[model samples]
Target chain A: MEHAVETTLTVNGIEVTRRIEPRRNLVDFLREELGLTGSHVGCEHGVCGACTVRVDGEIVRGCLMLAVQANGCKVETIEGLSDSGELARLQKAFHDRNALQCGFCTPAMLMAARDLQLKNPKASREEIRTHLSGNYCRCTGYQAIVDAIEDVLHG
Target chain B: MKAPSFAYAKPRSLEEAFDLLERPGAKILAGGQSLVPSLNMRLSSPELLVDITGISSLAGIQVGRTFRIGALVTHAQIERSAEIRKQVPLLAEAAAHIAHPAIRNRGTLGGSLALADPAAEYPACALALNATLVLLGRKGERRVPAGSFFKGLFETDLRTGELLAAVEFPRVERSAFLELARRQGDYAIIGLAGVADGSGRRIAFLGAGATPVLAKGASAASSLEQALKALGNDIDPPADLYHSSATKLHLAKVLLSRAWNTLSKPH
Candidate 1:
């Protein structure tokens, strides 16, 4: 077996320099190496959105990516969703509308939602559902999550 | 919870990336989503993992009479690309339906094509669009047509040390449709993407076979009924854990049916 190589990159607007195995998963790197555990690891096979995060302003599955691939790239985890310890509107909506249950998928979900809103600020309910259909929430049955996004969209 | 150790290489250039790729027991890390999981499962134990992310020149979208997309361009970039949206709407639609928002952000076009899952949308998009795949290695660069790209399940024409550089798709002013299952972030059990540009059409199916298979009959069909029937017959879907190839074949028919309807409609 080959050993992992060490490298550094930016995470959530902060430059994080660390030596890691070249093959270290972005999910593990974020959670274990960087200690940003907000990005959960669910299926690890990219089927579950629990490990979702943003790389260079785009939402992506952390588990599906390798840490080395993120070298010199800008990454945003659920931890970086807010500035100055304040939650973004989407976070508040998710909290207010009760969009989470186990909360394992919330970080990725919020990041994905944030990406969608960035692309289309006034996205319709159907558009949100269409864009967010990839992130799964087995606990909430998705109504509350959809409702949360709807509230934010309507507002 | 530790990954099996692997030697890592950060190639500074595309040539270096290709050189690293040519070595035995080497795997290229593009987006890393698919390759990392395979590594975690111990299904594929490559001794050396090439980090191509350092080669910044490989990431970008080039629009032209025939658009050339760098392999490193992420799915999110493609989905949000105004040029791709205007020129290759089917590709955009397919990219939009990929795993999830976060996955799209990191997953690269080249990486996904290299992974070559039967159910992935990019391969099917490539096939439907008749894209050209550009490969780099110690020798030089070569372009492979979409039809010849996939060799089998989880396989492609990629050599041990070769790197995929870019995918060139012919710009088509046509109507298209993409339809698939909602296993929600799971690989599609079935997917259909059809491109129709007045004179001829092309239909591609994913998750229905060992590789991305083109239903050329559907593309060759001059009428809607013929196109649907061609799609139904052309797809020899293989049975997997998700759905039997027979069931997927039936689903392929339905998906192509919808795609054909949308494409053949008077616009």
Candidate 2:
């Protein structure tokens, strides 16, 4: 079996190459190899959205995607979105609404919220709840998170 | 949890993919929404991971008299597609009931069908629509009717080295998809995907059995009351952790009633 596979992909805005085990998922690769720890690994499965990241302009569970599968793809983490100021308004809304508690699911929640904002800016409260359904925030009961996202969308 | 050690190969063509699949313990990797989770949980451990996403031919949607959706077409694509909404509205409706935006973004129709999860929407939708699955292998290509494609739980009739290429759904004028889940993105406890055409109605139920079951007895019934009564003869859904078998049957009847009403109404 081939233990190490060479993979090259653009993360955030920079291109990096590494020889990693095929079993290594995208989240672990980003956090361990590239030192981009903004994306959390809560479930290591696709259920929780804490490991959400944008690949080729679409948000996907980072833990479900292998690093080698992301080869030649443009990968964006929560760090990238924060650094690019793409999450500025959403961050502000979250700050104002106190959407986060313990800040475990905040990064992925923001990533998912920004996706909804870009795709459906005029999304209803129900739609917001539905869109963020995969992102489980045990704290805040999601009311404050929904309020924060609603503020960014329509407020 | 982490996936067990495995070799990965991204094949850009079907021939290369077939060659890789011929290797021992080779597993095809599609969207990996379900497979990756199983891999992390150590439920599935394949020695070789055959990454088939690089094959361009396996990803597209074509609509005409029949809607042909490639196996790799993601749920998000189906949900947002105007063409799908205007043509196969049932698919569009069912697509929204899938996990969520993130899972839909990565989960593919082929993966869902190939997995044959009784709680999934596509299998029931395919059975209701009488869709045809295009299977490609080393020798040639073959088409399997949706009725016989699903074998059992987490099982399909797809032969070894055969890949689900695309699904062809005949256009229908009236169709309805309804599911009752605990949460927005949770798997359906009981779901129905039904379509009415000139031949009659075809109703399929998910989470009713080991496979997506076509409710023949209820589908052939002329009236809603008869259909509701016939549902008992059609399915005997197994009990889950939360819901009783009797509760599931009741919920299935509820969905059938609503779908019957919707299909009976003129568009």
Candidate 3:
């Protein structure tokens, strides 16, 4: 079957139009089509938070959402967060706390942490643990990650 | 793995959407959290995907006689919905335990109810709350009570070409929810949703059997022990990698007792 849909989406405040395969997911489109690889694809089934990105105002797993579904929606990835100076404090906290080791999960971790910092600013350590539960770190850096997020929550 | 190639369409209106569903080998695509994964694994390869995101009319929260939630309302929306928190607190609590902050952001309420996963949170909560599912298809709109809607494991009363448009949760006086999972975001090994009225209580168990069902005669069990014993008789749990049927039934009783106490107590 051949399926192609022509649609335009505002990615990081830039409007781009493309005719792409219907099967292409948002993560693959961001990386392959737009060359925005900040969002990693860890679990294509949406278990891993590696492919997380803010759509409109909510974080969605990029691997599960098709690019076609993002048509006319605003997408904010880690690159956009950096460019827009949105992650300045969180980034510094991660670096200062050594929250990242291999850095494969850093971008998505930051994305997920940013959300926690805003929504549950007064969350306890356990709450922070639950918030970041979806994002996995092969390096087992839960303590540093939680500390970094806590630092920002209070910092 | 990437999903196999398939024809896709985004319908601007429900009429167009219903029309697309008539196409052979077409599947309705909602939040895509579940369907996309199945597609990527080639576990399901529909010839066409009828995307409903374009139908703006199919989203949002409406509070009237009952809590009418659009099928496209994401789990995150449910967690944050003040109306849901006030009216159906059990649903709000259940939504909080779905997957994670990100998955909850994209997983839809309608899709969860329609997929009818045995371990999912909504089915059990819906059963406990006596919620009604609104479906639309070529035959037009129909309302199926939650009790009869869920057929079996990962199955429902939803027919081919039928679209789960919304779910209506009846207003209840008191309710509480509980579940056991290996991890926070993992599927529950067993769960229960309990509701209380002036005299009696109703409890629904998830992952206790082929489907989320009432503890047989559990309504009459006035105490926790009775509720547990009633559940053992009601449910025939299936064994999986994580648990044996006996273990699941035992855990089901434990959780149901907790739910019973939680509901029986005053706030």
Task: Specify the highest-DockQ model's number.
Answer: 3
Clashing pairs in 2: none
- Lowest summed lDDT across 10 adjacent residues in model 2 chain A is found at A1-10
Per-prediction TM-score to the true structure, in the order listed: 0.89, 0.98, 0.97
**If both were scored by DockQ, which would come out higher, candidate 1 or candidate 3?**
3
What are the Cα lDDT values of the candidates? 0.79, 0.93, 0.87
Error of 2 at A140 (Å): 3.5
Ranked by TM-score, top first: 2, 3, 1
> Which scores better on lDDT, 1 or 2?
2
DockQ for all models, in order?
0.57, 0.86, 0.88
For candidate 2, give the docking quality class from DockQ.
high
Candidate 2 lDDT for residue B141: 94
Provide the RMSD of all predictions against the true structure, rounded to 1 decimal: 2.8, 1.1, 1.5
As a TM-score, model 3 comes out at: 0.97
* Model 1 per-residue lDDT tens digits across residues A28-85: 8888977888888877676767887777766777776778777778888778776644
